[model samples]
Target: MTLNLENEQNHELPSDCEETARQVIRQVLASENCPYEAEVNLTFVDNDEIHRLNREFRQIDRATDVLSFPMTDWESPANYSCLEDDETAAGSFNPETGELLLGDIVISVERANEQAKEYGHSLKREISFLIAHSMLHLLGYDHMVPEEAAVMEQKQEAILQALGITRDPEVRS
Candidate 1:
């Protein structure tokens, strides 16, 4: 997997944030049984930037912790079989690198800090949770409905637990 990460915010994230994101992405893809190499773009921005993005894209006035923009529409969440059947599958892969272009994720570092404090967890855990949540979105998962939200939440918690980045104060990453 290849991750293109950029930080536009002044907020200081954990020094190992990139590695944490990569780990979460890998875990999500592996759990989903994705057969192809993948690529993802992740960006860190301040509350103002994310608020603008939310208003522009989602039409929500509030600044969100994270937002995902997926590149493809899937018949089923995390199912790669549709890609094999679609003639446009070639468009989803990078021409030179041959990695599937997953999608983009934008995170608000300011919001993450606030959420971390509110949840009584480390910043690393909060960021990791956001990455995991957004990765699932990139793979076509959503939490708009209660059932879907439960599944997404379960998967996210499982991924974090597997990485040893849990909500418990005893566990730290």
Candidate 2:
């Protein structure tokens, strides 16, 4: 797996945040039992930039913590598969790595920081959660309905727990 990360914001994010995000992505993919070698592009942006993206892509004017643009379409988790030979899939692959391009994840660093404070967790934890959530989106998970949201949430929590990324006890109360 390769994570192509770009920092488009002015914020001085911690140097290790990129590496941490990569680890989180790896964990998510592994937990989902994804078979294909994959590549994901991650961009870190400020509130204003993310707001612009949200408006352009989703027609929402507010900045969001994360947005995922998946390259492939799968109906459900049970039927997840990556077809390397398909023309649609082939067009996205990296020739050198032969990794299937999973698509992009855009994260607003400002929103993430605010969410971490609001949710009483560390910035790393919040970012990790965002990455995990986005990875699931790339793998055909959606939270549009109650049942779908429940499943997605369960997968996110399980991936985080497997990574030993539990919320702090002090933060829970």
Candidate that scores best on lDDT: 1
| Cα RMSD, each candidate | 1.3, 2.6
Error of 2 at 24 (Å): 0.9
CA lDDT scores, all candidates in order: 0.91, 0.83
Worst 10 residues of 1 by lDDT: 164-173
Model 2: colliding residue pairs: none
Q: Could you tell me every candidate's TM-score relative to the true structure? A: 0.96, 0.90
20-101, model 1: which lDDT tens digit per residue? 8999999999988899999999999999999999999999999999999998787889988778865758678888999999
Off by over 4 Å in 2: 82-85, 169-173
